[model samples]
Target: MTSDALRVAAVDLGTNSFHMVIIEECREKGIVEIDRVKDMICIGRGSISTKMLDEKAMQSGIVALRNFLVLASQHGVAREHVIAFATSAIREAKNQDEFIRRVKDETGLKVKVISGKEEAEFIYYGVRNAVKLGSSCDLIFDIGGGSVEFVIADSHGVKLLESRKIGVARMFERFVLNDPISEHEIKLLEQFFAAELVSAAEKAVELGVKRGIASSGTAENIARMIRSLQGVESDVSLNNSIFTRREFNRLYRMVLPLRSSERRRMTGLDEKRVDLIVPGLILFDTIFRTFGLEEIVLSDSALREGMVLHYLQQHYDAGQNSDAPDIRRESVYELGFRCNWNRDHSEHVAMLCLQFFDQLIALHGLEQRYRELLEYAALLHNIGTFVSISSHHKHSQYIIMNGDLRGFSPSEKEIIGHVARYHRKSPPSEKHVQYSQLKQRDRNAVDVLSGILRIANGLERGHRQNIRELRLACNPDMITIGLRSHHEPDIEIWAAELLKSWLEAVLHRTIVFEPLHDA
Candidate 1:
């Protein structure tokens, strides 16, 4: 690989295993996956029900991640750029903190624990990039060891997202006690899954989603096993392929009578997943029947691919107007809409923030990266008002920290949250835990962006869009902001003056607000 080639790796610390893929992404060739590896750690095999990750599972996970790091280093991937995330098993485990600490201590890899909704969102991003669902709506499902994610979406955007704690490992540990699970157990499992999926299935039906897509290890194993049994030569590198309900039913029936030991000899089936296959098959069968789907397209691109695609979309050809792929300003605004925010006020504030950023770039000494974060902060600063008007800045920080804002790393998310949190009364300080936790550079970013956001928010204090444009005249001692508006803009100017102290302190210049036009 040349120096210019972008080599990145994504690690998914799943319940059943740890998966890592290295890819060299480029504009001309798109994403070229260089290598992929999976280790069957089964970290959730017996831990899901107990809510504890046993010592053996923790050690296995650490070893797996360490080995993955070695491979990534060998493939020329930068250590800091490697992305690693943990899913349901770790999220639900009581000893998760210990596991994370041990992994970091042994392997020097930071792991982000993501929520089920974020998991579903990432899955949607992966499928949207890999498979072409056209304009029609399609339901996508990913069954994991500790949970299952379902998403209803079209080519344009996702409509419905749901995730449940009804994964194969969890089901098998709870229901499958006998070899080739008993009919009573199967009946109980089916009832449980149907009850859990009732709301999502109804939503799918309401959306008129007839077609379906399935991803994750369980779906991939089933599709490959069925193909292998039908004398189809399995291609190791194949992904985003199609499989049918007929084929799934055939494999389900065939595996029903086989013991785990016998199933180990099956060509398509992964030996590690033999014990859990019965529950996996049962879960898929019930889902297919519930949704009235005859076929499902399979995407080998799961969450790991989703992370890589997000990274590429954010880094490649950034700021272009030609339909930025995933995680653009559109997605950020979509999140604001989901929170039922005041769109007019958020947009007006964001516009003013950007205008100020552009005009005083040299004074602030900030880059484009912080500018994007500022825009998001300005748009979502008032979202906490949905919770309560009093101390809404804190609420905004909480929301941004927890919300599913895609294409941002965990650190970046925290930075954005800090920026939004300081968009109001209190400025950044060493006493604020969130603000102080950031690195010095990030702390500086929060200070500068928050100062600008506060000024922008004040400029739109009336929420009437009275301030149409702003022109800044920068001098050594003071700066004059020329505001153009259709009204007197008294409230806007007063609010800005009140919040200009932080900006003035940071820039060492007094801010003076003046009206360019008065109607």
Candidate 2:
């Protein structure tokens, strides 16, 4: 019994259906679900043949949108607070522009067509907010109407985000034939799913992920089936339910031989989902077989919930300050400590690196996050020494790649790991997996910032607080680094020779390192 005040709404214009959720945010009672609406418009059904939405589909979609708009208006949701997004159906349709324009004209809702990656990210954010996951790594599988988005990440950040073109509705339309699907057609569907699952599993392996959890309609059905077969009460909650692989296989085998009517007659089968249930089972069975996952935890929340949580986190929670240690700085400091790196030397080098980063920010168009990453790389340039004194650069790469660094996204971690790898022995090259993952913009930032870190690390090689200051002068073709220190020139020369090659390769310019003496 909570007062319904301060409502927020999220609308999902999905490929198979239109869904809307209205939540009342209450401080004492937490989020109270006020209203929800769902309509199976099957927008993708129109685009499958013509690669554009058909007139009938457009009309159906309009009806659903109009209904959703009325619900939002009734709840007094503001235009700015109501977020709407469309998926594969809109993204793949040739007539998307007209459809979007018409929808906006009629319903006054602006729809954002998001990419698969963004979709996966939103889903992950949503699950993290709603589900209480144990310490084990989580792989979120979202099976929608036209596509399945898989995301693997821990509490740290997203490690893998990939999408495949297989969903319950799409699979049914493509392969599930016969009233109850025939054995021959079920086998065919299984083969097709098995192939796709193998490829996706291979990709997941490359990213070092093993566990998985289900996030959407198909998963909910599986949970429902489990509950019914166990003779659990219809009113039993799904919050603590779990489905084992063997049980899923049993359900799969049982459903594959049944006709659409037979499936409808089965317990816990929703009438609206009867046509798509066989293919959905096939998809799930294939995924479980391919990954060898023992069991899957079902999450009631998926994309819509994820979208709402993400919006709230970005707009509300992000503004509040917390006392947690800055993850970026902590990661950098830990890297140095693990390497047994000279603290005085690493800090001195980092100072010079930051100075260089600030000097060329305009030319590089680097963001503040990149600057933080650059500082991290500069501090940990010598992390490889802990493994072996020689070829420590390779060791540094291995450690950074494997170690869990909090507060860094997968992309940020890849950049920092690559930058650390390139500190001593090599320049950025496409041959390296981590380096190749960086976007063009980030690659350029890593290149310039890594150059600065290399030179700084070289300058502080004496390991005795010898280098007091560095004076940098940059010209069109060559940059000069002047080291002011009382240390022997031999120590400076040894470090400078290594710096020269790395600087030349990174900047494509000649570098001269010199030690200065007072007059």
Q: Which candidate achieves the best lDDT against the true structure?
A: 1
* TM-score of each candidate structure, all chains considered together: 0.61, 0.59
Q: Which candidate leads in TM-score?
A: 1
Give the alpha-carbon lDDT of every model.
0.83, 0.73
Estimate the lDDT of model 2: 0.73
Q: Which pairs of residues collide in model 1?
A: none
Shift of residue 384 alpha carbon in model 2, Å = 58
* Candidate 1 TM-score over all chains jointly: 0.61
- The reply for model 1, stretches above 4 Å from the true place, is 236-238, 315-519
Off by over 4 Å in 2: 1-5, 26-29, 203-210, 318-519
- Summarize candidate 1's per-residue lDDT along 79-192 as a digit string, tens digits: 987999999999999989999999999989999999999999888877665565556789899999999999998767788989899989899888888886788998999999
lDDT of 2 by residue, 250-326 (tens): 88878777777778887777677888777888888878777778888766567887788677667776311222224
